[model samples]
Target: MFRLLVMRGFALLLLAAPAAGAVEEALPNESAAHLSTLGRKPDWSELDKYQATITHDEFVQLFRQIYATRGCNPDLIKVELDVARILTAAETQNYFVLHFAKGEADRRPVPRWWAVPGALPNEARTAGPLAGFHIALDPGHLGGTWAQMEERWFRIGDAPPVEEGNMTLQVARLLKPRLQSLGAKVSLVREKAEPVTPYRPSDFEEIARQLLLRTGVKDARENFDGPADPEKEQTIAWQRELLFYRNSEIRRRASVINHRLQPDLVLCLHFNAEPWGDPHHP
Candidate 1:
């Protein structure tokens, strides 16, 4: 699933990053002061101290999601991407990378979009924004048999000692209980430990790239105008129909679940990564 092939040399570096997302709790002011004393440069010794955690792809996926909804400038988003890249890369060096740093938040890249004047996203700008909105909780995907989250520590650049499948179920155990306590209905995806399943895409990028390569459209990286004779509506019609069916499925699922459960909210939890983008620690 990853576009960039994995390398074996970076084991120590992966140590500094963690697998989980940032906590809901706020950081103390002094946390920022700690990272500064560490050199700002990215290297292997700077990375190995922490556990191997999030990947770049995970970070970028989220950035894209927020970008589409927030109308934030692309340039600003990229810096945070760079920061994650730098920090994680540094972890390949040493755990002291954590201690050497100071002025915590300052060490992190400042999001330019946050500074754009009077340009807050509608969600951010809203007061009591989600007061009446109900959400559904769906912990998506089945981990298939014995999703065991092993209790082990990972040094950077090393494979996870525990199985991810079990780890996910353990997480779901914690999550499902919490949401139900909050008066929210939870519809979790199957985590049964079985054979893996593949979801197909209707997007043209993969198909287009293959066709170009096969046809000797040498510069595969160059923007190849999509095939259109203004005559062939095949791809166009297929695109629209796929989109409609896909969107309808989403709504249909929501409606069916809500109708059955009379839910006030829908919450979908996704697990996994791709070659798409950088993973942010913050």
Candidate 2:
């Protein structure tokens, strides 16, 4: 009788093994052929129609449903607002892309849901209220040597001075970890105290000329026959450079936020300063 009972237990274990294996199976990796469809160009007309009818929340819900239907782990996909309103044709094809890990284990060209780090089971979101939110922090202005040119730096007396760019970067760094701890995905538009765009002042020399002339820095009367003195020429050039850098940096940051990160919310940090009432007093 004991031998018969042991045989019965072994049979039961064999029967349960397939169920356990199915539960433990990783999400299937997409094939290159399957991924090709994801890269298809968007029909702008269709996208416009969808944009008219589909609210942001509805799009997110639709994405989640599609993700599940594709046999992908829902945690591997993230949906953001695309608030910059600069979605490229490729990005417009899908609400979100599957994020994967790097290295030998994930040699597949296409992303695998199991490769995504910190991709908890769909049921694990109960731990944090913001489990699936994406947030972006944009620190305003170019700091470092460009701070003075950006007009975001001011020194009073022997004080260390205040730089808006540096201050915003610090704030973003502090806020990133806190948001991540709360289970929110966070990204910084400008990670450091530098310009995001590769454009330089010299690139927009013509625009700079118009700006300087308009601003009276290059007066027609004073420099009718070109700059009269080296000082006047230097002043015009500096103003032109500043204008180019300022506008280019802003445009680049917007591109990064809209095309690349596409976070649900954008927090632009800036520090405003008023002219000192008495420079010597405080």
By TM-score, the best candidate is 2
Cα lDDT tens digits for candidate 1, 157-274: 3654334444455666677766555444455433343322121223333443444444455444432133323422234333332322233233334334433433344456544422
Candidate 2: pairs in clash: none
Instruction: Encode model 2's per-residue lDDT on 58-102: one tens digit a residue.
Output: 445544454233333323233445321322223253442322223
Reference-based lDDT, residue 220, model 2: 29
TM-score of candidate 2 on Cα atoms, chains taken together: 0.50
